[model samples]
Target: MQKLLIIDDNDEVRRQLKWGLSKGGYELTFARDGVEGLNMFKKQEPSVVTLDLGLPPHENGVEEGLRCLGEMLRINPLSKIIVITGNEEHGAALKAVQGGAYDYYKKPIDLNELKIIIDRAMYLQTLEQENQDLRDSSVADCGIVGECGTMQEVFTLIDRVAASDVPVLITGESGTGKELVARAIHAKGPRADKDMVCINCGAIPENLLESELFGHEKGAFTGANRTVKGKVEYAEKGTLFLDEIGEMPMSLQVKLLRFLQEMVITRVGGRRDIEVDVRIIAATNVDIQEAMQNGTFREDLFYRIGVVNIVLPPLRDRGADIALLANYFLKRVSAGAGSRGKAFSPEALEYINGYDWPGNIRELENRVKRAVIMATGPQIEPDDLGINGGDVLRQRLHANDLSLKEARMLLERDMVEDALKRESGNIVKAAASIGVSRPTFYDLMKKHGVRNA
Candidate 1:
């Protein structure tokens, strides 16, 4: 049953509302004045409140009633408030609506009509509460799974910066959960109620990247048939997350910087500038400083985006987070797939902990997902994960002892060898396939002393 609170100074009015609502399948509470009603509202947190403009001290006065409503909303903005006033006070009731009341009622309350209004308020309030609960629940889901000092510091940073609108630059290795941190930030921010737009800067070609960010007018380009609103525009009063921002082209960087400074943008091929209010959070796997030095990235844009910086630790550096994350992923994937519960075997946990996750949390998630799908028994084993196969150093270690340096070298060598083999000894193709530039790939080859095949 919904809880309904009625506040009115008239003895007969309060008694009648309580009797009618109680019979209408509601748990009703009454307050004889604005002050008493506010106290009850704080204590009960009722789903719907019927507020009376008239009270003992300021009977039928709009001033005290508006104050009470404002205070109630401050405490719980979701509270459905319906203002009650006299037929002569109809103007005051309209003022109440302007002041944020959900609905208003006039003198000589019809028991049946009033009940119907309160019922609707109760239903709407229930829906809003459920929506807010789901949003809060999502924040808990995005929490970083780790006990390491580095992860704890990251958590602290997230909590400290989530309430502000400052631009956040997250730098970390691929698969280190930069996007997760971004989501946590959005989920806790003032704009949590709005949408969060995530764009992958490296995925789009340079020609289309600007159009994607600033939108395009119809016929702006060959493929443009319809006028489109870009991610930045769509995320008004919300957050826009630019992932892999280091890959954003220099030309687009200037436009982006202009937008950040002016809080506005001109659509592609359009003359008018549209204003947008949005918070930006960017992330990248590459060294932005190196990109800046190479003239591939703009130095001015770098300082503009990195107002607050958060560096996520790799999964290998997070120690026991490996197993914690594994179990968390297993449970989620199992539940999502509607399969029976699955768990990791002792041997599997040992192998997971021993592994230096070059791909970080992302690789760990993939391994766990694959194990859950392939496992014939309830417990996933070391062999279920492809990492434990071949001559991987992690497979050679005992559960209690593992070497990080050897694991990293073995992982890097395996990646380079696989990329080279896949590309048939084409250096450019190999580098692109492994997400590195040709020059970087050549340096890695020299560092590892691997001659070109």
Candidate 2:
């Protein structure tokens, strides 16, 4: 049952409320003063609270009541506290709201009207709690979150390629999760039971890379004290994820190409050739076509590795996926860190959607992680995110040389998203906020492909 706490100083008024709310189906508790009421609030932890503005120690004023209200909110910002005041106390009521009260009620309370207000407050509180719980429990698909059309196509391609042994070359900008794609393919492929060995071509020293790829025999070099299997041999009958393959030196590229063709490798000081059965999955943030043009990458090796390609779109171009990913990261990081439930302010969301994410997913995760730690309130403002809303539009305009029509469309889409967010996903209120008819708002939403909240 939902808990409700009623705080009032008048014996007559408390009696009247008790009679009116007895059949409201609530687990109700009552107190005659701010001190007693606050104690009950802390002990019972009620979801909805009705606080009378005239309590003892200031039974004729709202000062004591407001102080109690502030304390209750401080203890639990999600709690719903409704202030009950007199008809002439409109200013005090507004002040209560500004101080974080959920809503205000006037004196001479009618049982039916008060019950309706109480019911609405209970419903909103439940809704917010359910949402927070859902976010806490929700999981992303395959450790990835994407709902846009382009991402759907990418998902389809990943499934198709995971069923084959053909080499897959994943291309994307840095921080765009190229390695994640490779791992997903390996995880879903026929070699799922086998180990998926990974090596970054650029991260290793050039002189040692060849040795690392093809194991060396005992006495092969000063440090080669014993025979060891290289990545290929270790990944036998599995997958070898060669990250930053474009960074491999030309000499090593020839060796890799030879291994791909013959499925055999000779140790550095051994004459016998060993055959290994392994699938290759390469990833690079560089442009292989440009590298090949400059004599840095080999065309023959490209064909050997790029039998199939999966290109990941950058965060900025992924449409609504940007917000989807931001929320996913927020939930994931918040749950893991054991932080209080929180959400992004509408302005902060606007900035997030408008800003150009040059660093893509990695940057977004880092920002959200930091904001989770830095935020002091229930809502993460743009300042907490280290973003300036005013600068977002300017940065976007300068980053993309958009046409006049494209710019207008961008603004329209942003306005539509911002209105929906500010209005708490209420379609009617969102439409009214932007001075548009509901049908027109729906049309604009459809044109921009903005999903309903």
- Give lDDT per model, in order: 0.83, 0.86
Candidate 1 ranges beyond 4 A from true positions: 1-141, 337-340, 394-453
lDDT of 2 at 193: 95
lDDT of 2 by residue, 1-453 (tens): 999999988889889989989889899899989889989999999999999998889877889999999999999888999899988789999999999999998988888998898998997797678556544432223476676787777878888999999999999999988888888888888998999999999999998998889889999989889998888899999999999999999999999999999999987888899999999999999999999999999999999999998889999998887887888788778879986558887657777888788889999999999889878757886656775444566566787755575477568778988999999889999999999999999867654546676
* True-vs-predicted CA distance for residue 110, candidate 1, Å: 62
**Model 1 poorest 10 in a row by lDDT:** 388-397
Which segments of model 2 are wrong by more than 4 Å? 1-141, 388-390, 397-453
Candidate 1 overall lDDT versus native: 0.83
TM-score of each: 0.57, 0.61
